[model samples]
Target chain A: MSDSVLRWTRPLAALVVIFGLWQLAGRVWTFPGYLFTPGEIARAWFASLDPETGSAVLATTLRAVAGFLIATAVALPVATVAALVRPVERILEPYIGFFFALPKISLLPLLVVWLGYSDSARITMIAVSAFFPIFVYMFAGVRGINPGYLKVASNVGASRRERFLHVVLPAVAPMAMAGVRIGVAISLIVTFAAEVVGQSPNGLGRLIQDGFSALDYDQMYAGIVMFALIGLGLDMLLRLMTRRSPGLWGEGVPA
Target chain B: MTSPSHVMSTTTVQPTALRVEEVTRTFRRKGRNVQALAPVSLSIPSGQFLTIVGPSGCGKSTLLQIMGGFDTPSTGTVTTPAGPVTGPSRDIGMVFQRATLFPWWTVEKNVAWALRCGGTGRREALQRSRELLDLVGLGGFETAYPNELSGGMQQRAALARTLSLEPSVLLMDEPFGALDAQTRELMQEELIRIRQAAGTTIVFVTHDIREAVFLGDRIVALSGSPGSIALDLAPDLPRPHTHEVMRTQEFLDAYETVWACIRDQASAREPGRSERAAEQDDQGESA
Candidate 1:
């Protein structure tokens, strides 16, 4: 536990320094009302977590989770099948590439038109945005498995399922986890963006939009600050989860 | 560059082990036929260690690949009384020049995977894998990933995995060809020890003459394109050949004999090659 804390000390210290500078600037420049120091943001952030306002954060978190889960469900099997079959890769890669090339924000209007200004549209956008990175990373990782390992497995009499369960999945997990980590950050960002564009009933993005409409700069800053915290928290959670996953890091010995 | 005599004397035939009759392979590359192996014939008695050594581009690997049933011979038959070699056989294990261990599996799991695939129960297979690891001097590394091991250790894990299948014949394509000198020597010794313990027939291929000589009961020296066996020489040496035997006159004499044939082939490939034709002429006359 101490070791893990040490590992994060530098980043935590940097966070402190940034907040300290922001607070100092607010006090020195007589910009207290507008600048809204770290203390003010902290107070506001905690207050925003009150049962009524907290529901919005909860709704946004659920949306992000649903979007990411859907993306994972779609991407993993597609990536695995694509990796195993050359023809599938040749057929699907161009279309996937085309989708990835498009500006995700450009699809916001179409998504709202199709799914309406509800949670569905926001979640759908998030899923679509996160899908490509996970797919591409996982596909490459699976396809890059050394043929020698397969031959060894085949020569030994491993059924196809056994080979997949014991070898292929494990080999691809680290690369896939990296993609998942990236996708998690992307999904959160896209969810926030979707909420802002679609004018969803509640979310950090919607909250920020509402503050902007009311000309409440401090509230807008507070929403942005919360957004950053949520993103950081999710990423740290993923890193911890990956570190614990089997076949992830060099945790146990070979046997 | 030199040949070491095969020191083992278990040459008793154990029926038809492996048979290759007029096996030919050709690859169609953009409308041209590249004959890799042309109408080759060979056989190995059960339990004999036959090493194939040849010049580059001689299709030594192509032949081995065919024998392992990775690719079909364009023509002819590879008949083993045990059964037909279709795809890959659980009875025939293989180790490549590169150790192809799954980087994700722990050393023990990798070995156990082989056994489990060969129909051993999970618990028993895993236990057997541990024993195999112990045999390979990796007893304590059962849970260690391939990435953590040195090249030699990774290859050892590969050997253990191959052995876990309890294969009748183990096909190795220059398994230690990628290692440094010391590691190569250690691996060669390790292979000999493992083979002795397991009693698996081995068909190992290499370009290194010394390795071919060191490991083989009979060394098949193959020559250039349209690869065919140029010489089939049995090494009549004492059992359990050690490094000490490598320094003896008998070893030097055997090395010289093999090198003469290999060097002769090497020179013959070059244009304006000066002959040992005169030497052959004199030797022929003396004979």
Candidate 2:
């Protein structure tokens, strides 16, 4: 088979085989209490279609995406300006490094104490976790730009605004996007952790926590499956978006 | 200037296109001042194709940048007929050694953007870009991205982008320096043709002696570090140069003269090389 053809079919074939064996084993023997059969998990997943459960899924998605966007919006401009100005960079470095080194999840309890067990606190945790990677990548991207490009921009008499929009923005876009990809992944992880540990009213993480406490292994596995699907779906969508618009990521990277 | 295309009629009294008055550059590196260029002065007439040649680290690129107003000279001034240069203007365009085309843009859009900077509207900029692309022999590659093109073709696209501004004078810093030998020669020919069509005054900097001779009406050689003009020769080569002209005696003699000038500077600086190398090592350690 061609490489492109095998790329989809091979992994898919392994998944099918694995699931078939798992179902056979579960039916033949008594598995652990936490281990639910694939059939039972599917039934639980279908049962999760009620509005309350649907809102749990929605809560998780909103938290992750909003947090990622907020981090990106803040990081890109901050990094660009910081990299361009020496005094700003010097002032920002210590703060950036300190925050980046901190475990953002540890702040969730303190934030919950301050803001209550609310979306704001959870989203803040996710946003704080997402900021560091985005900022670092963008700062390096702006700094790594070829001085020659700026010289060319000046020689052509491009004004400051035009140069930023046309030269600096496009040049640093891929770096910013890479940072965003990582940021989104971090937001998803942080959102789940914050949701579960903070004991908020509703979220996929809360649904999983409820299932575990009730000894409803099927619902727990189904919630876990939903997270995996959401992750895969998001990654596929983002990759597709970047691939579709080659102009945004095309040509060569900044020197 | 129009009557004689070959351009050695100093008696014609063409108005000065660009004048450099005792310009020098000193860069501060590692808490020490490193003088890149000594006080250098030269006057170029309108529509003249002048080439500046020197060895590496000879500060030829620095001179070109100063002329283009991309860098300020430590002292002295550069003036065009319109005004004294405070910074880069639309009247003076530049092409760097590396093609600085926005990778996101296709060949045509790159040229169009330069035109758009001059306040040309969308349709007209695209139209002018098409013409410029064709002029640079990039007729069919308009929609192709910079990465898809070869080094020579990218440089051609860069040249087209700069030319779109309709600048009266163009400053190029080793524009062909990075290309392979064959591509470099071909680009040299392309530049000669483009200069003829546009009649734009040019100051082309290169380390290659033969390239300096083949494309220039006036060749100025700068010696090693703290470089100043070592020799200025105006070889009366035939106009509308072709590749075949490379075989002519006029071309060969001009080549030899520049080659000798550069060779002499190399040996003269040979004794000071070890001292410079030690200084560089000290700078590296400090850094």
Candidate 3:
């Protein structure tokens, strides 16, 4: 076989073996209804493709994306300012560390109470959760720029704005993108978790909860599969964007 | 009697391009004051290439930084024809020991970015960048990234970027020090050519005596911990120097003089004879 074919064969074989074992176990053992067979789960996943579930998926995706955008818009400029000014960094350091250390889920009840039982509450939770990772990574990126680049800028008589645009932005973009990738995953997870815990009116998390209450095990499994797919799809989309514009990020492709 | 026009002609004078007036730099480290560069002074006329040579820890870099207005001297000033330099100005450009090109930019973009920062329009900057790349012998590699090029090529690109600013003075700190011996020699010749073409006053810092001799119109040898100029001599060499010029007796004598000065300074800092002997014995056993 060719090298390319051989490279893919091993992973394919392992997946096939695992599915076979799962089917065999389903036949041999008396498993709980909630513990679904792979075939049954696949069938349920296709069956859940109605207008209602599709809207639920859209609702959840929109919330996650909005929350991520909000976090980026707020955190990036704040982190840039903090990184540039020592006094601001000193003031924010302790509080930033404290909030980052605090479990984001623990604040979900307070957020719901403050913002009421609306989409705002869930978004607030997701935004707060996503903010720390992106902010910290961006701060580190700005601080970690090679000092020589700044020297070159100064020597060439680059103005303050020019230095920020040309030197600082390009240098920190790759690291900031790394943080954004993690933030995207975090935003999705926190949005879904907040939906389930807060009992929001619409979303995949609510659908899953409704399925459990209605004894629709298949529907719950389908909801989970959709969640995983959405996260994976968004991450891949981000990776593709980074690859397309290698100059902006400095690193050409994700490893 | 002389006419009024004759009097005006006689009175006209050109100001010095760069002047370092008794500059000194001291740093505070671990609650102790450390003198980095002692009082040193030099004047560079316009369109001259002056090279500064010294051993490690002699504060050559500190002095260069001071002259470039990146760092302020403790007790002296660096004056150009305009006035005393308070900070980094557009008229002076610096090239570091390593190529400080932005890795994200292609070779053409790197040079163009410097021009853009200096207030040139985008299209004109790019056109100028292409011309500079050709001048630096990197005509076809404009699209290549900094990491894609060899050390010599990267440094050449860096030189092109610095030149893009059209500065009156160029301050280079060991620009080709990281290259191989052959590449360094080639770069040295290329630099002389560029200097002649551009007619910018250059203050180049290096530890290599031959490099100092090859490129400099005047060579300044600095010595000691808190560095000061030990010797300042102009080598009597012909213009448009070549490899054959390096082989001549005059070049050898000048190289020997610089080498002896550095060697004597190194030995002067050595400990007593018994300690030196013991250190040599340890090295002998290790070898």
Best by DockQ: 2
How do the predictions measure up, each by TM-score?
0.87, 0.90, 0.87
RMSD of 2: 3.6
Complex DockQ per candidate: 0.37, 0.63, 0.43
Q: What are the per-candidate TM-scores when only chain A is compared?
A: 0.87, 0.89, 0.91
Judge the docking of candidate 1 as incorrect, acceptable, medium or high.
Answer: acceptable
User: Mind sharing the TM-score for model 2?
Assistant: 0.90
Rank list by DockQ: 2, 3, 1
Q: Pull out the clashing pairs in model 1.
A: A253-B143, A253-B144, A254-B106, A254-B107, A254-B142, A254-B143, A254-B144, A255-B142, A255-B143
| Residue pairs with clashing backbones, model 3 | none
Q: Write the per-residue lDDT of candidate 2 for residues A1-255, one digit (tens) a residue.
A: 599899999999999999889999998998987777777788878887778877888888888888888998999889999999999999999999888899989999999999888889898888889999999999998998777778777777788899999988888878877887888889989988999987878889999999889988777887888887777877787778777546666336544
Across residues B19-97, which tens digit of lDDT does each residue of candidate 2 receive? 9999998878779988888999999988889999987777787788788887789999999988888898878888988
| True-vs-predicted CA distance for residue A39, candidate 1, Å | 4.1
lDDT of 1 by residue, B1-287 (tens): 01122233354435556889999877764687767677899988777889998866567877887788777888988867776677678677788878887765677877887887778899998999999999988989998877788889988999888888777678898888779999999888888888788777799999888888878878888775567777888867555677676777766666676777877877777555335643432222111
DockQ of 1: 0.37
- Model 1 regions more than 4 Å off: A1-8, A14-40, A249-255, B1-12, B29-32, B267-287
Question: Which candidate ranks first by TM-score, i.e. highest?
Answer: 2
lDDT per residue as tens, model 3, A90-192: 9999999999999998998998789888888889889999999999999998888877789888877789998988889988988899899999999999988
